[model samples]
Target chain A: MLEVKNLHVTVDGQPILKGLDLSVGAGEVHAIMGPNGSGKSTLAYVLAGREGYEVTEGSILYQGRDLLDLSPEERARDGIFLAFQYPVEIPGVGTNSFLKTAVNAVRKHRGERELDAMEFMKLMREKRDLLGVNEEMLRRSLNVGFSGGEKKRTEILQMALLDPKLAVLDETDSGLDIDALKIVAEGVNALRSPDRAMVLITHYQRLLNYIVPDKVHVLAAGCIAKSGGKELAHQLEKEGYGDLAGKTGAAA
Target chain B: MASETTTGLPYADRFAAIAATLPGQSVPWLRELREDSFARFAQLGLPTPRVEQWKYTNLHPLTKAGFEPAVVNGQGRGQIKALQPLSSLLPAEEPAHRLVFVNGLFRRDLSEIGALPEGVRLDGLGEALASEAESLAPMLGRAVRSGDNALLALNTALMADGCILRIGRGVSIDAPIHLVFVGAAEETALAFHPRNLIVAERDSRAVIFESHVASNGGVYWSNPVTEVTVEDGAEIQHYKFQDESLDAFHIALTEVEIGERGRYHSFVMTSGGRLSRQEIRAVLDGKGAECRLTGGYLARGKQHVDNTTEIVHAKPHTTSKEVYKGVLDEQGRAVFQGKIIVEKDAQKSDGHQLNRTLLLSDRAEIDTKPELEIYADDVKCSHGATAGELEESALFYLRARGIDETAARRMLIEAFLGDLGEDLASATVKAALQRRVSNWLAAI
Candidate 1:
């Protein structure tokens, strides 16, 4: 469903992603594992159309359309979702109200009937029950004074509500404990379908235990160093990235 | 103090022409008060930019207009009827006791004061002076002094008519009392001076909503002064909404005195007038008293709004809080000057003040000054002021969620001032203010 060819990205004139290429088909889950300073988060941000990230040379194709030409909101309406590592804390906007606005906006862009207050409440209740999110958390300001676990759950709740076709999880298990990691993985696994795809970006292989991926790709420097099956994660965990970095340099 | 009479001498002649026909001119005490105030105003003239209090505000609008006294009888009820369908300006669901004044003169035909409770009186100042002068002798001009400022002196000198509200001891009025002042000038530019006096006896409770609105596109000046006295253990909430014409000018002064254990809360919302200033001076005279001064102003398209306030803690164990916010767009300019003073013997006094401004355009300007003067070692006082554009991260977060740029900006601005709006006691008034905020946002 998505293809990236020789993606070159720069931030403030400093090159971060250099000639990176990747492709994923429909209904497939890809896990991009790398050490620190790898361009895993940058790829997610670039796909979601964040500002200040200059695309020096590359082309990103999403469902046969150029994704880089769209704005952030347009990309959101086009079914591209990025679950941020650090959810922003908005002081005055209630979480429920924000979710409603976003849901309606996406629905309107897709030429669908907008959900009213009653219908929206019913949908939110079903999602809350499935994700085990508290009702009081939705009543409070968005992510303001929320715990790390709560924030991750809120992001998962939003994902369930929006029901995007392509979801990019950026370090979704960074600050989560074991229990929270299990909950988040369960939430992600429940949304798996034949037409949906996910890109899980992580530094460690701990999350791969709960939500197993079909393909595992090791990202070193900026490009994809190696691609293998799920057994590759166990090998990477047993042996550090020191040997892989050298082999990847020779292969590139 | 440069007392040179170059640009302000014309107002002296204008005041002289209307002195003979003003209300309460026959009373010797009132006559002497007007004469003294006129002399003071002549000496001070209009406060120039050199005056410390008027440094950020320019009075050239008032001086250049050369306004004359508003004709009381020239505009009839038909004109007021034409200005009707005022559902947008009034409260939504609650039944309010309304006192309507046109051009600073009490319009009996347009006012509706539905049967008030016993021991409560709400009427015009002219009527109260003619019948109950003895009871009002000690209250009038007591909270506000003549020599405090130039505008107060001018208001005292040419004061015509305004509303007077009095509540007896131990009585509580449930419904809000609304005082509406509508300004409609004729071919000649008119200026009106309105003086309002409110006295709540010991242990009494009441709420007052004061609105200044203009009906036509005429250029006029509405200079109003209000004096409030909250007796021991009494409570009062005052809301002032100013929405005048774009070509009009407004200058208002409010003086309040809170007794022992009394509570006073005030909120001022401004979104009108070419040039306007609302100055408030409150003093906590008795121990354990509390006062809250909060306001928000939205200025756009060359409009200017200023809010200057001073709160004095003269007794021990008193507390005061102040928060003022402003949003300026286009060439609009705003000023906020807030000062808190803790006297030498006022031990254990606590005060906090904050002023925040949001500049929406490159040319918009805001001048904020928050001052704290503490003479008591046991007092706690803190003040802060900030001015900046909207936060970039917050804006991006909203936009990334599919909200457009304009809707995101409006939501952020509303959230910035949401706390102050939620502080109001009446849901109806809060809803009205929210609607006004939305309207102001839509206009810009």
Candidate 2:
């Protein structure tokens, strides 16, 4: 469902992702582990079509089409989602209204009927209970004064609502505690289907235990150093990315 | 202070030609007041950039245009029909005691006044001047003086017609009094000065809404002055929406005085006019007096909007708060100057002021100045000013949720302005202002 061939990217005239390659099929979950400043977040932003992430060379193909040709919003309408590392706190924007606008936008793009206020509220209540996001939290400003756990839980709720084809989770478990992490994992596990693909980018192997991945790849200096089964996550956790960083000229 | 540029004022001939026909012409005191105001205006002339208070605004547009005095002949109902959309701020179903003015002349045919509560005076200024001249003599130019602003002096000199609202002692008016001023200049460029006087007697309460709009897309100038007095323990709520034509110029001044334990609250929204300025001066006079001022402005194209305010804490335990936000795009420019003052004897006074602006284009500009002068050692006072563009991260967040670029920009802009109206106590006024914001966004 997604393919990256020798993708090279730069930000503000500085190269970040160099000759990175990856492939993921339908219903497959891949975990990309890397040390700090190894282009893990860079790859996620590139796939989401954020501005200023210049593609100096190579290309990205999603469902046999050039993904770089579409805008950030177009990519979102095409079922590509990116959970930001640091969720933006937008004041004066109600969480419920923002979610409804986003859901209706994507629905209209897909030729599906838009949900009315009552229908949207019903859907929101179900998801809100599942993710433990209370009513007051949704009524307040989007992400404004929200705790770290609440922010992560809201992101998962968005993912469940959008139901995108390819989801990119960037450091979703970084600020979450074990209890919050379990709720997020349960939400993601419930959304898993044969037609959806997910790429979980993490700095540790902790999240792999909750939602096991079909494959694990260690990224070093913007390139995949090794590719293996789920056992590789445990191996890397026991030892660290010290050997991979040394071999690829990336500092640990 | 007169320079070569201040010598020639076209209004000298117009004021001379119409002094005999102005309101309250028969009264000697009113006539003397007009003459003295005109003389002071002639001495001060049009404000030049050399003056510190007028440094950011330029009156060259007024000098270049040959704007004649607007005449009230009562001949343009069709033109007013075309302006129905922009003139009314209240909902259609809402029962409002409204008074309409065209070219600064009160239009009795277009106004609707139900049975006002006893002791409440609501009518045209011209009518009041003709009958109750003695009662309005003390308030006509009491709060605002000719030396404070040259344009205000000019307004008093050539004052034609406006609203006169007075609430008696201990009376509370339930319905809001809506004032609509529509500028419909035909062939010749016209200029009108409207003077509005509002008085809330001891322990009285009232809310007043003003809408200044243009009926035709033509060159005109609307210079208005509003004077308000909140007596001991009285309360007054004032709101204004200025959406003049893009080819027009608007300059307005509002002066208010609050007595012991009295409260004054005002909110203004500006979105049109080629060059405009809204100046407000609020004085907290007695102990426990309070004042609150809030506004939102939007400027696009080559529009220039200015909001200048001064709040004075003159008595012990007086309080004041102010917040103003603006948005500028294209080559638009905006200016915000706020000054807060606590007198030497006004101990325990509390005052705060804030001004913020958002620039949407590289060419858009903003000049913000905040000043605080506290003489009392025990007072609490603070002020802040900021000018910045929209956050790129916030924009991306909205777009990444499948909202288009235009929709994303609209969402962020709405959010930026929506933050200003959260504390407004009037739901109808809040919704009206929000609709104006949405309309401005859609037009841009």
Candidate 3:
């Protein structure tokens, strides 16, 4: 469903993702693990088409076409989602109103009819219980004064709403409690299907116990240093990245 | 003070006689107030180009136009309905009290009232001064230099017809009192001053909504002053809406005094008039009083609106907050100048002010100044003013979400203004403000 060939990216003229390659087929869950500065977020931002993060070279092909050529909205319409690590606080904008606009935008881009308020409410109720997000949290201004856990849960709720083919969970589990973490994981696990793909980016191994990935790729200095099965996550959690320091400069 | 001259214009004598009556009032204190005001008016000379507040809004056109009062014609049912925006929002069918002043004259034919509390007095200012004059005696014609606002002096000098409403001690009025000022056709250049005095006595509570409506292209000048006194433990909510024609000019002054444990809330939504100025002075005379001034303004065309507010913490433990937001379009200009003063003895004073302006067009302009004068040693005061277009990040976010750029911008603007209205204690009033906001946003 997603393909990246020798992708080189830079922010503020400093190279972050250099010659990174990755491919995720339908229904595949891929985990991208990296050290503190291994450009994990840089890759996610590049895929979601955020401005100011320029792709210096190479291209990102999604379902066979150049994904980089499309605008962020167009990319979402074509089924791409990025759950931000820090959900933005937009005062005065209602959370439900924003989600409806986003959902309809994506749907409209695909030649789909818009949902009325009634239909949208139906969509919200279904996602609310599954994501464990309640009405009180949704009634407030979009993410304004929301706790970190609530923000993450709300992001999962949006991910559920968009139901994009490729979902990028960027440090979404960083600040969640264990229960919230489980709920977030279950929300992801329940959405897992052969037709959808997810790239779970995380800093700790605690989250891996909930949503087990099929593969783990250790990224160091912008390029993948080590690639292995699910057990590689356990090895990293046990031994740390000391052993990978030698392979940091190894050939791709 | 050089008396207003009929020297150049034929009907100038009427101006002198009307201006002289203020100096002849019984109270020596009132005479002093009028004389000082006349000096200020003469020196100021109807706001020349030098004055910052009147720079964009020129009053010369109003001064040069020959103005003569038209007779108080009978109220037109169809006409009032067309101009009234408060019809549905008001309890018109429930027989609530309403004081209607059409063309600056108190109209009893169009007004209704119910039994009031023992000490409550809702009557025309003249009648209130004639019979139950004691209630309004203390507040009838006092305009302070607290804010250095010259318009208040003009209103005090040229005060014509309005009402004095006093909700007596410990009285709580559930029904809102509507003070509607309608400006009918003015064959000649017309100048009308409507005065409203509300004294919410100790432990009393009430809501007073004063709306100014006007039509006709004939040059019209409305100088209105509203004095609200909230005694100890009283709560007063005042709403002032200005929706005059583009050719008309409006100068409004609101002076409020809050006693200990009083809560005074005032919101002024100015969306009309070619040239409109709203000057508010809130004096916290007692300790532990709270005052909030929240407002939103939408100016299009060559319209110019100025909202100037000064809140004084004269005693300790006083709190004041001011939030003024403006959306400017076309070549319209909006200005908000708010100052909070915490006196030397006013310790533990909390003061917060925010003035935000959104310029929808490159040609539009906004001048926002949030000032603070603090003499108290221990106090918390913050003032912020921001001037910019819509956020590109937010706009892009909404656009990326499929919300059209125009709809996204409108939504953001509505949210920006709605925050102020939503802070009202009464949801009904908030809803009314919201409706007006949406209408204005949609029109712009």
The whole-model lDDT of each prediction reads 0.86, 0.88, 0.78
Give per-residue CA lDDT, model 2, range A1-252, as digits (tens): 999999899999998888888999989999999999999999998998899999999989999999999999999999999988899999988899999999999999999999999999999998888899999999999999999999999998998899899999998889889998999998888888899999999999999999899999999888888899999999999999999978887432
User: Which wins on TM-score, candidate 2 or candidate 3?
Assistant: 2
Q: Better model by lDDT, 1 or 3?
A: 1
What does candidate 1's lDDT look like per residue over B248-359, in tens digits? 8999999999999999999999988999999999999899999999899999999999999999999999999999998999999999999899999889999999999899
Report the C-alpha lDDT of model 3 over A27-55, residue by residue, as the tens digit.
Answer: 99999987788899888878877788899
The TM-scores, one per candidate, come to 0.94, 0.97, 0.79
| Per-residue accuracy of model 3 over B1-444 as CA lDDT, tens digit each | 123441222233454455544322555555555566655554445566567655545666665666554322212221343334553234455445788876665777677767776778787774443344444557775434443455665556555568878888999988778777777654566666677888898999988777777644546777788888899999998877787767777888788899999999988888878888898989998989999999889899999998988899999999998888889999999988888999999999999999999899999998777778999999999999998997766765565454656777888898777678768886666776777777777875
DockQ of each: 0.67, 0.82, 0.33
- Lowest lDDT 10-mer window, candidate 2 chain A? A243-252
Compute the lDDT of residue B383 as modeled in candidate 2. Answer: 86
lDDT (C-alpha) at residue B420 in model 3: 84
Query: Which model, 1 or 2, shows the larger lDDT?
Result: 2
For residues A1-252, write the lDDT of model 1, one tens digit per residue: 899999999988888888888898889999999888778988988988888788999899999999999988888888888888888898888999999998898899999899999999999999998778989999999999899989989888888888888989989999999999999999999988888899999999999999999899988878888889899999999997878777766776
Chain A TM-score, cand. 3: 0.97
